[model samples]
Target: MPAEERGKGPIVTSTYRVQLTPEFGFGELSELTGYLRRLGVGGLYLSPTLQAVAGSQHGYDVTDHSRVRAEFGGVDGLRKLAGQGFRIVADIVPNHMTVPVPESGNAQLWSVLRLGPESPYAAWFDLTFPVALPVLGENPEFTVDGDVLRYWDHEFPLRPGTSALPLDELLEAQHYRLVPWTEPPGYRRFFDVSSLIGIRVEDNEVFEATHRVTLDLIDEGVIDGLRVDHPDGLADPRGYLRRLRAFTDVPVWVEKIVIGHERLPADWPCEGTTGYEALNAITRLFVDPAGADKLIQTFTQRTGVSADYGAVRYEAKKHVLSLFFKGEVDRLESALGEPGLHDAVVEMLAAMPVYRAYVNPGEPPSAEAVRIVETAAAEAGRRTDPGAVARVAHQVLYGPAEAVTRFQQTCGPVMAKGVEDTALYRWFPLACLNEVGGEPDHFAVTPEEFHAFCAVMTPTTMTTLSTHDTKRSEDVRARLAVLSELPDVWADAVESWSGQVRFDPALDYLAWQSLMAAWPIDVDRFTNYLLKAAREAKTSISWIKPDPVYEAGLRDFCRKAVEVCGFSVASFTAVVDRYARVNSLGQKVVQLLMPGIPDIYQGNETTDFSLVDPDNRRPVDYAFRRALLDNPDDDTWDGQKLQTVTACLRVRTRFSADEPYFPIEAGRNAIAFARGDKAVAVATRLPAALERRGGFGGDTVMLPPGRWRCLLTGAEHTGRVPLAHLLSRFPVAVLEGS
Candidate 1:
């Protein structure tokens, strides 16, 4: 298939991402069709709807692939929603399948356990039997039933002729071994999540079976597009995409993370990434590089953390590998058949700049892949054995097939766990800059760089500001960006707050930042966020390593901070309130009006002060939003945001994403651009700095000659417009040409 035809699917004008859970499923979504239509969304970008473990909140842990989840109103409810005329962009998990608590919840996995290697479904998953399941506790006891082996409410299938034997003898006869709960499993898993077992989707048979229901939905026109979750986790991402494209050409977007100046491979048969690149790019425009030094210095001074992010990240990766990825390292080390290469392999994996190297078996590695291997090896060599680095690097590119494939697969999860989960929490110079697939050390992007990024965006590629995975919501980051301008004031406030109610010095700075960033948050929300932060940082406590006394102190610290320092934090927020609002509105307008099919993550149409999962996935009070829309109030921030989003979406239809983009020469405080001949987007960047410099002050953006009306405020203009006038009411101005 031609690469141009690879990702082509239904034309999605705009999307509203709905987190589908038992609380909100297809039936619930069906009820919101009228509201969604009014919200200017053309498609429902849904979370995974495949049948997963019963009562699963996020459906990424899919137990079966052949059926739409009955809990999510099943296939009938989905078809009924499709009848509403909105495109359905389904989020699909192709990398792994869930191993539910009952163990029998996934029939194929159960059958495999019962029948061993002779099971017809043996090829479906990547397993190395006797499969080592980590379900045993210390001093574990077992009981036997008619055809099952039981251990404290957990059951396993008994092999034929093994049910009549002694418990110990029966265990020996079984196809799988049970180990202590803390031990890593012997089978391939999605990251360190042993329950979410990795599937061999690279196999054609596996692909057919796994994607059958989704494909059937596509054929039936019930599904219009696909958002492939965690493509980097797949063994042959490029090959898997090619096979998927062969089957159907719906706008297939991979949840691929691209780092600094790295473009998604043009040859890959899919649409671009699900838009961390765009998210970072949008964030960069608002972040002032000038403030990086002050912020870094302030952060270091306050928390005693090193200023170097790369070093901090490298250490974090090494720590994460030792803690969570020892099983993967051991597997690769065993595959290499080379002695004493374990440390070198770990170092290289830790040193990897991107998620993974695209070194598929038989086919030669891409230049990008080779570069990544060489770069990581070079860096790894600095700390470990250079000879080992050379040997491992060679093996990665030209060694055993199993070694090469496993090495590639392992890098992504290692990076994700080490960086996104660990390093991001550890390094806190400017929390706004610390996003997925982004370097916080690299503080900001110039307007020219942002424009260059915007110029090449794929029309149908997804663009978004916030997602379920973001460290903070779009508005939260927007609010935090104001710190770049007022770093001195922020530093003083933290010092004063610390004096009043202090925690661990290493984490106190971050806690204060979070408190102010997500202001109006109560005790429970604030304490829960801090606890997660403490665990993710793995400083004094971690998810695996529980410290009861330390955690209690952490909780008490949060309470004290909120109760004693809440008033002070609120006062500081009030000071930067206007500027933060400007940034919040500005970035929203820019992201929505820019190229690509923008997604409005639930409740982000107004303002969502969320932090990470479960928090970000909190129930959106749509009734409140609906009421606000019913009675529009420009006087309020939420109302202003609603007005901005609706305006951008309204005029977004007039501008073709692939059309010629003309960059308008506005002053440095503002970014201005025209999308084709139809719409012009102008947003205030660095509002605090702009204010410091006596405002727009004769700064003008040359508009196209002819009548143009501001879509946001309904103001009329005929040519060059002053920045102050164009953005009088709001910080962003979207003008539609007459």
Candidate 2:
């Protein structure tokens, strides 16, 4: 397996995370190749390109596995991109498939519905026997038409002839049992999503069926690598990876969430994680740890929320289980064979430090994971059902693979829904620290930790600052990091503006902070993001049943936030702009020069201040970016952002995987490191601290003790110098051996 032949090579991947809908499909993406190439991108890491549920913006809800998305120009478009010599890394959803209402497009699911247990495809999905797929309200009396099964307002298309039977008989004849959407049915699904059913990809037949097109694309040279989405949801991720590796020898990266201090399982066959850990490490290094108390104070005063992240996480998990995943909890309890053990299980899951432990049957569970479970159970104050605990321990440690698999799958979604989606919006400590797989409680990443992480994991890691699912863009986060510098100014702005408008205290605090970070925001983007943010917080309103009165209040607040507070907005923007420039260039330099295959999210070359989802996925203005790239004299902050990225990436191409990484002894206000003897990245971490300390008056950063040319300014420097001299030209200095 030569590096290129095995799809394992040094890559500077650019992530195209938006879906290929009719408006922006393959044709649209194909136009960016030359621009990407010129930007120094080595490959395109694409979103799920397979067929998905109709009109899905992000292709995670894949409905078909055997072909490329029809709207995205299918295989030909992929070949076209690859034909241009750009390596393609495709995202594959092996854990689940969409279960649309009509059941018309999915042949296998429809067959199972029509033929019950006798259908050959019945074994493909993770359904308990005498199968019941919940499609209608609980115990509803239904009427039937020619081919429609009607339950109240909903009419579902059953198999043509089966509709002729009474609704009850028709339901009984189907392999899946249709229950209310609210019911946590026995079947495994992707998280608590009722419409996305989990596939038994651990089954040899299922794996083959689901991965047919993916394997073909690899064989045909259209795709050079694989990114396995939500491997935590799979029954046997390790086994599946092994099978996938055997099936195709291409490099693979799992979308595995490694929490604080946890590493990816050593035994799994893959390149590395999709890089949330690295994202956490790099981003938090830029955040000021001293601001944690003030932010928590503001959060507490307004929202009346506690500062304890763990308690909030535990309660949020409980809330999700009770309100949303009641049936799933019930099922897990049943599997444990003890009714009282429900809370205990939920407690253990909520306390799980990492996404999951890689424990195989007949093998011991990781001691650390065992300790986490035991501690959570004790702290939950529920007397352990010894027998039930033993049963669960057996499943987690030994056989009954399905039980353990479901348990593992359950932990990730609970953590995601409880923490990232819910608690992150609630906690206003720092929006940047509340990223995916990041711990808000842990305010900063120490230099020692960052160095150690890069030493071992950087070789195969996929480091990124922004991604499609990020709560905020990298630059947006960069701007927000500046808020830590002037906590008093930030607190004053929040207090003064918040006095004029009435909104949910906590939500308002969060909104104002976010608005400051992305100041001069438009009405539409602000309103939409606020609405989504409020719903995700779920304190006052929710996604399923939004509170109209609360939503109206939010809209008013958003309007006032932009229209009424011009002075405060101007003041904050000025401060943010100054610090944002430093943060932006520093991050760009470090990310590109860091010890990993760095990925630049589209449109992030400039100072992107976009928020999560639809906001982050908005169409890129390539023309504007290209114009900036072409105009060397354009000294705007966006140009600086682009220049820093370009210079480091070009310098990066010269370094090999075996390049030596030495951490530099830059002062506390800055971080500098050398990549071998050639590349030195000196990034300013705390601009506020430096300004207070009188601009590195006596501080010095020892160079490689030889002549080095500044990559950005082309200035020459030798040996030690006032750190001010090194960073006077740019907030960050990227230098190479002269």
Candidate 3:
């Protein structure tokens, strides 16, 4: 496809990552396509469609790369859905594959095991010790001539005649031996995720096979683009991407997490990342940095630790390194071909700069930073040999800074040390903060940031808000904006309710924090989602151990608090009325205004009240969304949100038909740009507090002489009316020349 074709119109996309079961059918996808078309979405960006292990919800664990998953209705269904005119972008996993064992079926398990390095598939995987890698940390009593690997299959049985054992007793054996690779069978492999054996995609044969599957799909017109998952995991990302691009015309986007201003290699054939950095920029712009600082200090004081940001940062880095690099060090040592060079390389890289040096205008980190890392490595070398130290350092430094930043942010609450530490710290805060970088503060896409983003965000790039992995649904985040302005209201309610209920103040704080963070609003169908999440979290003592007996008491407390604080059921109803008005208007504005192709995850146009991961991945309600799409005049809030989104999309498409190029000038909380003077899209992203503070004052916007009307409210204001009144509704003005 031509590059301009991808960017010629507004993009509306959605993510589908849940397991494909018989319950979800071709009819559902057909209905979904029509709904999306009505919502003005340009395409459907699906998660991996390749067959995955049984019951895998997020289909990243591919077990068969060549076949479409039957549960999702296979190729015919996909083609039928694609015929609806929605572009299809498939998420592909090229870095690794799920290793199948005897229980999974084929008898090639034993053949591959006994053949060792002689097996035809030996070069397909990145195996460590081909000769003796133990499958389950066991030393088999008998050594076979060929490579031997073991699997923990509870189904295999020993013959009674040979072993004098009952079938059930034999089946109880913990490990079954067989080899998948010929290398030393006893040594462990990298990625530490044994079930997901890594592939050497840099190998010509392996690369060809992986590319063939994707190429075939593109050839069949079932897929328009590709999203590469975990690019950093590959040995040569640039090489892999280049080769993949060579075979197909489809646009490719790598899932790179940007930190600071680091850029992807300009030479690579892919466009840009999944936009974690953009998400971060949006959140940070809105979040009060001073509030963040206060929370950090208060957390430290309460914990009574002599800790700075760096210390917490280091600890979080350590945790991620442990998970991702536990076994990869030995592999690095062998590759470097020197006893101490691995450690040296690690120290040098860490000190060089956490970000890609080439992308930054500032010279890499100061020499002092390098010197400091060297010093630390030297000391570490003394305790654990230099080679070992370097190995550890390499793993730590190579991991993305975005991951490190996330770790640092989470460590604050983790260090607070609550019951069910696992539940409190695992994914909640990380998901909440994932969108922070996209906010205006940290990564404003200011004229400066915009220039940078524009330079990077090409046609192949994917822009989104609610993915399967996001902590909160997009609608949830949208509603939470209301709370950002009412922190005192939340704080006061929690305080009074905590006192009345006699719950631990700290625990009460955390509970309220989660509630505020979750932010269930009446407008976007999120209140029910919030209630569901609360109930789900309550099931596991891990998230909150609010005395079991007090579960009802706590819920009642919440009910009363929300009511007494004027956020009661009746108040919530009132808020819903306002939300209906705002959400419809806002959805239309976003659908019409954003420059990049907009992505709408399944069911989001009507109401998306999901939480992160599994919650977001729940089977989309195509029936409901289809009903809304079919009924253009359904007098409901969700229907309104959909209608507005559709209207904006139509407007955007019409405006960009002839002349699409334009320049954007920055204003306080607003972006002003002219679309050939046929229309001007002035998007207001005012902070809730600023909006409540009577809005910003200034005639910072200088427009060409003309009469203008706010596209949203249709309130005409000519010749530079007060920018404040013009911005009251967070207007996205599409001014037409009179």
> What tens digits encode model 1's per-residue C-alpha lDDT throughout 1-738?
222354444377778899999988898889888887787777889999899988988999998888899998999999999999899999999999988888988998999999999998998888888898999878898888789888886889999988999777888998999998788887889988988999999888989999999999998989988999998888889899999988888878889999988878787877667889899999989988888899999888887889989889999999989888878899999999889998899989989999877888898888888988999899999999999999999999988999999998999898888888888998988898888887888888888988888888777678899998889998889988999888888888888998898879888888998999999898899889989988999988999899999989999998998889889899998887789888888898888878777888989989888987878999999898887778655568898888888888877766555656778888789998888778888999999999899999999999987778987778898788889888888888988899
lDDT of 3 by residue, 509-614 (tens): 4444444444452222333333334443332222223355544555555554444442433344344334323433443353344444555566666657566555
Candidates sorted by TM-score, best first: 1, 2, 3
Candidate with better lDDT, 1 vs 2: 1
lDDT values, one for every candidate:
0.87, 0.77, 0.49
Give the poorly placed runs of model 1, Cα more than 4 Å off: 1-10
The lDDT leader among the candidates is 1
Top candidate on TM-score is 1
TM-score of each: 0.98, 0.94, 0.71
Q: Return the lDDT, model 2, position 72.
A: 85
lDDT (10s digit) by residue, model 2, range 1-738: 224546545443434343456567777888877877777777778889999877878888787888899888888887887788788888899988987756666777777666656779888887775555566654578777776666665455565467667656877765456766556666778877877888989889989988999899888988988889999888778889999989888778888888877888778888787877888888888888788788778778877889897778777777776666766666666766545777567666666666777665556777875775555545544545555555555555454655666677777778778887887887767778889998887877666667776778646567788888889888888888887777777888778888877577778777877787776688789999999998888888877667788888788888887888756777878877888789888877877777767778888888898898898888888899989889755778998888888887778777764478888888788888888887898988878877887788888888986788887888998899678888887888989986
Backbone clash pairs for candidate 1 read none
TM-score of 2: 0.94
RMSD of each: 1.6, 2.5, 8.2
